[model samples]
Target: MNKKVWLIYGMLALATSTWGSAFIAGKYAVLSFEPATVAFLRFFGAAILLFPIMWIMVKNHTKPTLKDYGLFAILGLTGIAIYNICFFLASKHAPVIKSSLFIASNPVLIVLLSGLFLKEKITKNNIIGMIIALTGVAFIITNGHLLTLFQLGFEPIDWILLGAVVSWALYSVVGKIVLKKYTSVESTTYAVAFGTLFLLPFALFETTWQDVQLATWDAWVAIAHMSVFVTVVSFIMYYQGIKEVGAAKASIFINVMPVSAVIMATVFLGESFTFAHGIGAVCVLTGVYVGTNTKKWTLFKRQNKLRVQTKDSA
Candidate 1:
């Protein structure tokens, strides 16, 4: 494997780690604020951080066309605005660890959607990997009770988190196409700016001056972390990783997010580390290793064999 590819993977690993922790931040923020308010503040903070850089980039290039603007708007709404709202709402009711497991399913959804629209082929390995990852997620969320899905009461947050996953998958696949025409930074900046715009009215209705006035220092710190790390840095790294490794391969890294979140929760929030969590983590790691490494090993063996044959001929 290329050293640069490994570097990109490392960056993505860090990005996913930061994202996993954002759930904890989101949970805290939503305790005192409405979901829309939290979403608004997060994006508003991101816009503040990204706007100057975006302006500098814009100054160096020509303004985007109307079509480009439309793409930005769509990306903004789906990826930033809608995704954050659903996530915050879900985190309000569900444990962050549980939500992370569901969110990890985004990669599987992305692969399926890509295969549907991009004409990507789905192999047996892909199916096996997805099933294994999803089964682990099921265990985490359902606590090994498969039948609880039809139980008397259901947490609406689970459905909302699932919606967030779907929205993020759509955002990623659509952004892949848009990135063909724009640099990642430019695309992200416009999308975030537009998303903030789209979220403004809803935030206004949901948030009040009193809420802002009443926010604690911890709340502000959480918002800042979400804006800088989860929103800006993570998105930038994710796009870079996807560029280095194609989306199909790049997405599998999402499996790490849930495990990271669970660990963070256990350490910082005093959440219990159950036997089920360990089992699910092992399953997820096994699936990722089998799915990603098998092909890599096959290629390595083929290359070595070719080298040996060439040496013999010489």
Candidate 2:
């Protein structure tokens, strides 16, 4: 693959890995900080860090118009402030497996929404790839029993999860267009800044320095990891991916998240890798291959095979 494709792959992989491991990191951070507080600190840290970098990147660039700022404010509210609050609250009440499975359908929602809002094509290969990828995601998360679909129930909290995914789908599809007006750096920074602003009131209500003061080393490490890698770096990569690939194709990479999380848990948390992991990984990769515009290698091989067959016939 070309450098551009490789860069996209690398960025997507890193972002997903950081996000996958965030469950562990968040688990640690929340031991001290409230979920709301953790959420706030993440955006606040990202926004603060981005200011200097944003200046360096945009100093000689066109200034974002007031209208652009307005759109960014909405972006923050939807993607960062609102989406996270809903996710945390829903996670408290929703069944873990069901939530994972449903959230894994995030790409599917993005594919459909991109078609509607972004006018991106939903191709046959993309559809087939999404199905295969999601099937693998469900298989791994459910440990391949497959009967959990019949057993799952949708409580009211589940709707919140659905809302969270929809909010993010809008964020991804909308942000793709927004990037045309702003640098990836500028877009990410402004959105995060606004999101942090909106989150301040709620976070301040629950946030106390006592938890931070009392936090263990592990908790602090997790806080930094989430703030830097999960929120900041991951958001940068995500926006870049959306800009490089269309939203639907970019979203497909998220299927790797469950696999990443499980692998991280196994290595760091001393969990076991099972047959389901192996199978699910294969399926996930296969799905990604199909979903993406990565046909050059396959086409090359097919052409070579055809040439050899013709020579043999002669």
Question: Can you write out model 2's per-residue Cα lDDT over 1-314, one digit (the tens) per residue?
Answer: 79989889888878876777665676566667666677777778777788887787677766778888888988898888888777555444543333444455565556667888788887776787678867776665567776774587444675687687788878877787788877878887888888888888988898767766787888778878877888777877886788888766676677767656666666665656668756766676676666664354357668999999999999
lDDT of 1 by residue, 1-314 (tens): 89887898898888878888888898788877888788888888888888777666456654789988988888988988899889888778877767776676566566667677777776556567678877776666777675775673346676787789888978887887887877778888888899889889988898889988998888888888999899887977887788778766666666667878888887877778767766666665655554444576457768999999999999
Cα distance off (Å), candidate 1, residue 292: 7.0
Stretches of candidate 2 above 4 Å error?
Answer: 1-16, 86-108, 154-164, 233-259, 272-274, 294-314
- As a whole number from 0 to 100, the lDDT of residue 114 in candidate 1 is 69
Number of the top-ranking candidate, with lDDT as the measure: 1
Indicate which candidate wins on TM-score: 1
Clashing pairs in 1: none
For each candidate in the order shown, give its overall lDDT on alpha carbons.
0.78, 0.72
C-alpha RMSD in Å of predicted model 2 compared with the true structure: 4.9
What TM-score does candidate 1 get on C-alpha atoms?
0.82
